[model samples]
Target chain A: MNDMHLCVVNITFLGKGPYTFSVGKGECVGLTGKSGIGKTQLFRAITDLIPAEGEILLDGRASASFSPTQWRSKVTMVPADSSWWYDRAGDHFPVKHKTSLLRESCMLLGLEPEVLDWQVSRLSTGERQRLALLRALQNNPTVLLLDEPSSGLDAYHTGLMEKYIGNYLRQNNPAVVWVSHDPEQLKRVASREFRMEQHRLYQIK
Target chain B: MDVIALTGVDLGLAASLLLLLSVLSVMLSLGLERKIIFFGCRMTAQLLLIGLVLRFLFASGSLLLVLLMSTIMLLAAGREVQARQKRKIIGLSGYLISVCAMFVSSFSVTVLALVVIIQVKPWYTPQYAIPLLGMLLGNTMTGIALALDRMTDQLHGRRGEVEQRLLLGQSWQEASSDIRRDCMRTGMMPIINSMAAAGLVSLPGMMTGQILGGTPPVEAVKYQILIMFLIAAGTGFGVVSAIWMSGLHLFDARHRLRLEILKSDKV
Candidate 1:
């Protein structure tokens, strides 16, 4: 693990435990848990979407000092069921001048550059999932909180997503906390692993 | 033109028309017999009560009384506004929001009209103040209620979409901007539709009343035009205020979308 950017300092989520964890720059921290164990709720809390106690820090700065906008930008969360409000996928992303990086991201994910032009309604679940990930990456977030990012993908597409995400990770050096059920994917992607069981935090590896 | 007065017999004849409606409901088996009878009685009682109260207020000619009357009207409107919402804000915020918004819109507009536009003898004369406020407050209340209703429902129903934008580095304002604008527009629809259809479809209530009371055609038209504009202004301001303030309630200091501010929407 490189220099730590994302640190969860005794963050307690609804009697779930004073959760203590950290993800270093360029490291993907994978979390596995049984369904209904409040994984999504924890993401929301970290995003400050729900009210929770305990201090979260980014690069040695306290969560309290940072405005919600600044905090969310630094610690962007990609939800499992990604939301698309616009007619076209391109509208969801920020207006940017750099196309080369975006195009490279598309190519890495096996998507054509014109995929951004397609309407959200026309995109398949796999396509939407990948695009949602790409959209979040475009924001240049410092800490990427991914919730089951590749859950909907088949083996081939999942591989492409993992590959593209891995590429983005290396380039950006962002701290990542990924929630996934697949152990094999965890083994491939995560350097450190933790299992959430019965409201208790256990570090497996 | 001489103003015509309705005698007691004439009033009795109007009351008899309601009996005919009750008979029709019974014959049609529409299950509206109880509702029709109750509505007729309620209308009679409400009209009598408002008429007596206005009469006493106007006779006394007290500014405090006029203000008190306006407050009572605003509070009643606030309760109605609270009742209309499908997704209500918990406890006092709902009442506070609607009442404050309507008070700002209706009271301000009524004062401006009385002092500047109409230039009545006294600014708070009950004769001018009560009727004008009644009309303005009624419209403003509906507008505020509709805006609040639509906004709450939208926020609750489409949580995922809103949270997505926020997660993508948009502020709470940017994330919910579309829904807010759309809700305000929806709130103002009744007033806009009324204005559009006023001339072509049917005579509005104020105009029709003036005409029947033997006001000249042009005179009635003038009064109706002024009233409509007043309503439009009041409703517009009221809708804008409620929806914008409710946005504050929806998002916390952390800029999180707190649908839990609503009483029913736990998810």
Candidate 2:
């Protein structure tokens, strides 16, 4: 767990705009902000979906040195809206181990294995979000970047997400960076948290 | 009635039938119903005007006039290609290259085959050269435009996936192979369709004309076979060259697909 250091060295948004934080390995860091405060943009930038001017270091290696694909595989992101091109869930997680992981994840999130074969187009917003979380975890990424993972979920589903994520963190000790507006959810899943306001990150006790 | 007299009247009647057929085609396929009437009208007018000019050029029997007409044909083909491809092709280079290559190859084949092989006197005669050139150039222009447009659109649409492939250690060619294959398939479809229906479903224009001009049925069939082969060859070459030339400009030095360059606001 303490074998590596995951460093987000310096990420600047819109030429000095909001919410940049660095988290170490085996730590769960939560980001909170009002809507439209550039939290999503920051997630996209970190994932290299949007261009950013800074350095991201994992195990002391600069992120720019790694190609976008390699960087993404190493540090995976589950966006707020998990849009997928393929219709089948099996298409996303093909391996048996991955399917098992997803099934377990679904059970924890109160989803059924039947949902795996269901067409993604038919999945509700909550179902898609839960499936996205499972897909992200299936990759066994070094650093997981999640943007509002439980936003669309009901209270029951939200509790399931927290339980699964909490178990995963305790068992795997992988670095998790979560973005959410809900304080209770943050208190449950996050070991440390910060608030983004007016292009700045303020540490929240 | 004399056999020769009957033959002459038959020719006139056939010409009238062709004229009527063309008008009916325009009305049915286009008319005022389709919003793309402008393209149809332009095609009709261009074909008629070219036919009139070609008639005079053939009668005059001058090499200079034939050359002038050929140049005009190339220019029109170039402009049509450019107009259809608007933003997909960034500079004038793709248009110029495609048109020039199509003109050179098709014209060369027509001249060498018609003059040297068939031994037609006044090798630069418009009667033989103009119609052949028009067919080849028209198909090539269409093929090039489709290839360029499809390639550009696919590259832009799949930018994320392409970049992901690149980051996964795929080279530029490897990353773009799928898109390139798709574009090539799109570009070659018309030629393939025409080839499929060459003899059975429709009598090609050249063959029908040759038969109307009193050439033997066997001779007309031979010319049709030769011309069809030539057109397919010309179109294939044009599509490959256009795709190759345009594809070079689509990527940056880093081998990444350039999104800004390929972006079409209109699309």
Candidate 3:
């Protein structure tokens, strides 16, 4: 359909089962699976982080058409445990995104504008996770690949994160592939749901 | 001034000094006693064999013989570089890259000095060519080894950071820019320090040997200066080429970090 923003057809990686799926604009497709059932690998393969064998399309264009960096810019992933190379938390961001948009994203995600000034080592896991979301958002990605974006957050911060992501989806109309272990969170955020089992993706009603 | 030739008796006196040191190491319960004696014997044997070979090389005076000797030296240096790395790239590419880097840097610099700078007669004269190549190879080998060792270790230790950058839409070069710069600095550090410390902190081995051989002190110092500059340039080029090649090898065609290709050494 013309509304399709991200599409995966028979993708397979690490000798796992071939996975086939697609997500439309403004749709959050939540994936739930047991630990080590290839959920993260699936996300990696979709984003071309790892080698995979299958066709992945973004906005009716094959991923192979763009360079890896170009493709990833449009389909960014917020990993569960983010890493920081620079000392200051703000230095990790691209300069163009360090403007007011970053400040606004931080406030919406229940983070302070001053958090950017803090040393990366001093930031708590929750703060790092939230900043990682902001980092992904700054790319203006057309499709988001989220792996446990709120795993480090408490209930209150989780609500704020969910609201921030929801607002982002409504405004940008990006297709999101969210992998979460919490069924309740999936039910609240995802309109179409799927569960990963033995590397295969199954759509759930 | 006539140079004093070292005789067997003189060398025997030096051997007694080593024996005394080894005995002292044993008496002090130092673990280096056996290593000292073993390495001393190994050094003697290796030097004697090379002396005989060099004599024959110089007598034969053929360009083919000189090239053969140079190739052998390059191979030995390549093996030394490979052995020094704790984590090495899998397959022959690792060996090839090291050898190629040394060959490009050391050989070219040695030839340039012989032909243009020093203007030595016959250019490939073993007396001048072999020693110069040997020094360049030795220094360049160490620089390459240090660079590659630091590179693999840093890449493995910072895997999470590298992948995060990749997911954030960075090219392989952009993701690895800091690591490349760090490795280059590590490789170049020793030569830079040695150059800084030369003449003041310690007498360089070549200048000391030349002076001991009864060459004018000022002449020996001039030669030492040339050799030092040559070694620095060789090491610089070798390290840069090796690091650049290794950097390219770190990522796959699609710009993914294929850390799997590096085989970790068993400590």
Candidate 4:
């Protein structure tokens, strides 16, 4: 991909916090850090979920000007522990193609189709995490913010997640800001990486 | 019919109704699955205690007693708003402003319209003044609380999206427009629903009481209309004032959300 296809963006938090680097158009950019180093803050800042000091541009258009609903619809964040407001996964998926996406995502995440009808309260941590990813993708967001997407998954499910994410990135070309603490997972999917430390982001080659 | 002789029975029935209402409130709370039994119990006890105090004051029929009771009501309303707010409101200014606004507007309107316009003698009569003031104050208090709660929640919850809008070159007013609208709507929903349901779903208290007191149905309807209008006006003013005052509380001199204000342990 050309450099112009994926523009560089600077995301700063609070008025004086350190700036974080973001890159991608349809690429997967892995963001790794120890807990509480502002990784989630960075995601929120980039998606315009929180107040920040820096500039984020998509295709050379500054993201600062877009309305929140527009920005969120375009660039979505899927939190690690997704809280459900509905009882069943089916209830949460409102779109027509939702079932198809759930089926495809379930196949990718090693989840069964029957899981969709299960009560959200009954779903295990791994299942919910997988379901959250599927839900986030349902909006066809231009940029995906994944906050520890595999935190609750077993090794088998984690492997499925890695494959699914890799293939999805290749097909969709939607940029990703994937946050993870797992080194092996990072190496498996991330084409570019940035490690957060001391509130500053350092690009990892 | 010698109805005046049944004053003792009337008092007893009113007391029993109050007790029944308290029980109904408890059952409603349970049905709603709220874990607020303690809060509900405290509110019931406080209201009953206030009722006893007011009964004594009414019997005395002193202007000084009426004024003291009104002051107490205002203070209690203020404290209730503050407690319900979870102390997310900054400083004492918002609570004070809300109390003052609700008190002055509602009290003046009730006194002037009910007493002066209608020419009810003994204008300081607790039976007339206290109940009217109580209705206005109670509704206003709830309106202010709802407005403040909704405004604060929207501002905090959508902070990120708001900042992004600002970055995208929207003015602060434009960026926070959604929050403002949503907060106002949320705060006003109850009043709107009540207005819609009035005279249909149930007979409102003022109208029912007026009818029981032997007022003609047509005359009772007029009073109900006036009371409902006054409530809507009181609620509107209370909500607007609370939201405007809360806007002042939300941002600091630096224009950042004073997040520390939201961290009260009182709730």
Using TM-score as the measure, which candidate wins? 3
How is the predicted docking of candidate 4 categorized under the CAPRI scheme? incorrect
Candidate 1: where is the Cα deviation over 4 Å? A1-3, B1-32, B265-267
lDDT of 4 by residue, B214-240 (tens): 788899999788778878887777777
Give the Å error, residue B228, model 4.
8.0
Which stretches of model 3 miss by more than 4 angstroms?
Answer: A1-3, B7-13, B16-34
Interface RMSD of 1: 0.9
lDDT of 2 by residue, B1-267 (tens): 222445657756755655676677677874533434455557758867867876788789898888888888788888787677536555666567667666666677777667776677777766777777877888877887788778777777776656544433355677777788788888889989988998889898889877777888899999888888878887777777777666677765445465555435374
Q: How many clashes in candidate 4?
A: 8
Give me the overall lDDT of model 1.
0.87
For residues A1-205, could you state the per-residue lDDT of candidate 3 as single tens digits? 6568898989888888688888999999899888988888888888898999989998889999999999898998898889999999999986564468788778888899889989999999999999998888777899999999999999999999899889989999999989988899989899989888876888994
DockQ for candidate 4: 0.05
- Mind giving the per-residue lDDT tens digits that candidate 4 earns over A122-147? 99999888887887777677788889
Point out the worst 10-residue segment of candidate 1 chain B by lDDT.
B258-267
Error of 1 at A34 (Å): 0.5
Quality of candidate 3 docking, DockQ: 0.84
Give the range of the ten consecutive residues with the poorest summed lDDT in model 4 chain A. Answer: A1-10
Candidates 1 and 4 compared: the better one by TM-score is 1
Q: Model 1 clash pairs? A: none
* Model 1 interface DockQ: 0.82
True contacts kept of each: 0.85, 0.03, 0.88, 0.03
What residue pairs clash in candidate 2, if any at all?
A18-A199
